[model samples]
Target: MSAPRMITVWGRANSVNVMKVLWLLDELAIPFERIEAGGEFGRTRDPDYAAMNPNATVPTLVMPHGYTLWESHAILRYLCRTQPGGNAFYPEAPEARADVERWMDWTLASLNDPMRIIFWALVRTPEAERDMAAVAKARDAAARLWSIVDAQLEGRPYLAGECSIADMAMGGFLHRWFSLPVERPELPNLAAWYARLKTRLPYATRVAVPLS
Candidate 1:
């Protein structure tokens, strides 16, 4: 198969899910166009976007040959595996690839699942519109989730042992956790891991945007 030439991403800039896909493109040095559609944009509900993705979510990818795809993490893995030298992130061996792929799956299935509420409540919600009680509850839940990932990071450089798509994908949410004004415990390991990620060019320029 030949290398994909043109790819397009659809989603808002601030969406963490969308941010992950965008960051992946940056990592692969893949050039693409992005059109804002979800959140305040309202195009997600339109028939055109819905036809592309029935779920009507952000970070949908339009492949070179017009194959449309959705789900943020899926898009990242596809780009990593399909693009030239996909092995760097996805790897060539099953154990190594699965090591990275499992965490990418975990991010969508586990880590990111709990973080949605806290992110929306803290960053997206307006001051007057905010619910302190719910935000606090979500914050506590999110902290526990971070602890799980932190535990996984005991001595490893990143999830699944390398800076794969999992790192870039989960890094989007982790960036929010560190940057937001919410109070959190002194998770030294997680903090250390984050310090290393923040130094990356993509994390510094894209994933490391202002929290609110």
Candidate 2:
């Protein structure tokens, strides 16, 4: 029998969190229906969506066995395991895989703060309503963070040098960092890496869409 299919993802398309899952699904070549939720749509807090996901967050995954999954990164990891060739996205080794996981974790743990403010100011919030102060702070902080990534890409093609999940996970946020309205100093290495990631199908179809 074929693998069961009852997968549905709930989230708005413009969300970075939602984009991560979409890009992963695209890379895995899994077909899924996405219903609009969260952000401006505001269905995330409804009892129906809440019942499936208590956190009321976008990008909830309804599995074939009727299991519900929440949190964006968790969904990425789950899909990486469930799909065929999943190990390609998230490997099953000790050294290289772990290193990839580290950068993916860093995107959520560290990059989120900086990316959020920058994203909101440039994409979500209108020009007059934007908080220039917060945007500036986030831009500076994110640039500092990018400097670390710049150093990491000294001779690598991708993070961990193989286009693993770390690149996609972090790529979603870095899209905004490069596109947002801010003065960024010339960091050729980071810029070049971002350019290379743009060539991926997932990055082009999902992550590289107009922010917001």
Candidate 3:
């Protein structure tokens, strides 16, 4: 058998994107070395770092044999495809996998915009400097989107009916949503699904932390 590959992840712990990869890595039982490199850590702009990821984004993956990859969702998909137990988390069936991909795409295409507004306002921006009006509007928008997810979870435990990449993608943002101080409309199903995810050690320790 070939020697196990060494995987190194570059990004700060508090980043939602990085947390997605970390949570999935833990679930896959993959060992990796993580280097702090974004937010206050601030090495993403360095020439060497930029060479690996021109976008200067966090959560860049440095694989064995010098392969490099960036973009959080892309990294999540790549790792799932190459590592053992990949199919368990990222099914191979066209329809089943598409179900997972749709949610993951929804997170990026739909949910993230409003969610980021709320996250930045409440978590990143100081109270004295917050734009409360903007925050409120964004919160409302995000809540509506989450309600759709709540309805999706009405009779299922995971986003795609079975634990898969969809859950990993959304769980990172879900952790932020429930943790934020803003009032949320009743989303019991979403709350319960989050509660179930909390039972997982990775979600408990990594994803479900104080907002940055």
Candidate 4:
């Protein structure tokens, strides 16, 4: 009999999408191998890496059986379906699962672009090279979007009423949004939620790293 192949994740550690997957794996205690790719590591454009992820994106997941999956959110859903102790975060019930999924989708659709703009402007660009106008625009956009999240989190400890993939999806940006050297509106609930996420070891270690 052949030895089993371990699941592999290809992405750089600083990627928020990659961090989400890693945090969940740790939360579920699933062991997997990680290979550095994307960003400064720069394997993403290579033909071999492109074959695995045609988008040449960070976080291409290769399952133990040799199945390949791309897109971070899809990988998160697949892991929740296949791994033990996953249903707790991604629930089996249709409506309940949708609730969790809604925020994940929302994070990608509404929150991602503005946050990316803000991060690249403030973190990646040097102070002299910074585009303060663009940064201010993105900052305002992010604040408006985050206000919706703040309202949703008013009576809930986590999005979707429990610590789900929704939180994991948005968690990394929470770290960045708060950590960035920019003024922010007082969203008390969002602040509190961020504090809650900080208490989790997996979140702190995986998602809350210094912005690169």
Candidate 5:
């Protein structure tokens, strides 16, 4: 492994995507400096920031050797691949690693579809202008997705086994799912898995904060 290098993360603290990376960094005990951008901070639109990350998305990572990466999940993989103790979290065995990747991919490809809509409606949309009907439909869809996860957790402690990056990716969003005002179905297994995730100090301190 090359010498350890300082990393810089650009994003607002409250962003779920940003929080996911932060939680991973903390879990790995990697030292990093964070700059608040995006959302109300508004630095993401700056020309220099745009040049670094064309998407202008929160959680852009600037690594040693001038390597820049965007997309929260990609950042997670980069850190895991390069850092010591990565195999435990990311795994070197192809099958073991794929087990982790599937959940991380599902977090974006499947879960985010409904979860994002509901999160925005309930958390961002003002009560007076909010469309409760739309929120309800989105919430129901998200619940169905969570049920699938709940079933997966029935026989395992973590999604990909032993609390890998898969847990962090899904746990980041799970915070929103559990915190929302909408009623949740009785997903005992999912609840237990979440409880296990919460026991991590890094997750509790960084990712479990109040939602915006």
Candidate 6:
């Protein structure tokens, strides 16, 4: 009998998208190898890398059978659908799954832009070169978006009413938002949800990390 082929993930550790995949993998106890690519590691633009991921993005997944997948949220869904115990995270019920998926979509569609702006301005840009005005504007936008999340999480411990990929999708960004040196509106539910996520070991080790 042949040994099972291990899954390979390509991306730098600090990337929020990559962190989401890693956190899920750890939660599922799935073994995989990670290769450094993108950011300072710099293979994203290589022809071979582009062949694997034309978007030149990080968190590309090479499956055990040699198939490749990209897009972090899509990858999260694929992993949960295929791996053992994945159904617990993704759910088999249509309505339940949709609840999980909508937040994933919202994270990419509504929350990502302002979060990216805030993250880049505050973390990546040097203080002398920092755009405080842009940071403040993005911060306000992000706070409003998080307010939506806060409302959604009002009676639930996690998005979709249980721990699911929706939380994983937004977890890293939540950590970054709280960690950033910007003024933020008081969001109790969001803060409580974040505290709940922190107790999960995978979230603490993988999603919550010092921003680069």
Q: Lowest-lDDT window of 10 residues in candidate 4?
A: 1-10
lDDT of 3: 0.90
Better-scoring candidate (TM-score), 1 or 2: 2
2 or 6, greater by TM-score: 6
TM-score, candidate number 4: 0.96
- Residues 1-212 of candidate 1 have per-residue lDDT tens digits of 22246798889888888888887787778789888888888788788888888997897899889888898877877887788755677777878887787777877777765577778777778879988887788788888888888898998988878788878778988888887778998788899888998887877777888864
**Candidate 5 Cα errors over 4 Å, as ranges:** 1-5
Superposed by TM-score, candidate 6 places the C-alpha of residue 112 at a distance from the truth, in angstroms, of 0.4
**lDDT: the better of candidates 5 and 6:** 6
TM-score of each model, in listed order? 0.91, 0.93, 0.96, 0.96, 0.95, 0.96
Q: Candidate 2 overall Cα lDDT vs. reference?
A: 0.84
Work out how many backbone clashes candidate 4 has: 0
Kindly report which residue stretches of model 4 are placed more than 4 angstroms away from their true locations once superposed. Answer: 1-4
**lDDT value for model 5:** 0.87
Model 5: which residue pairs collide? none
lDDT of 4: 0.92
RMSD of 5: 2.8
Clashes of 1: 0
For model 5, the run of ten residues with the poorest summed lDDT: 1-10
Alpha-carbon RMSD, each predicted model: 3.0, 2.7, 2.7, 2.0, 2.8, 2.3
Q: Rate residue 209 of model 4 by lDDT.
A: 87
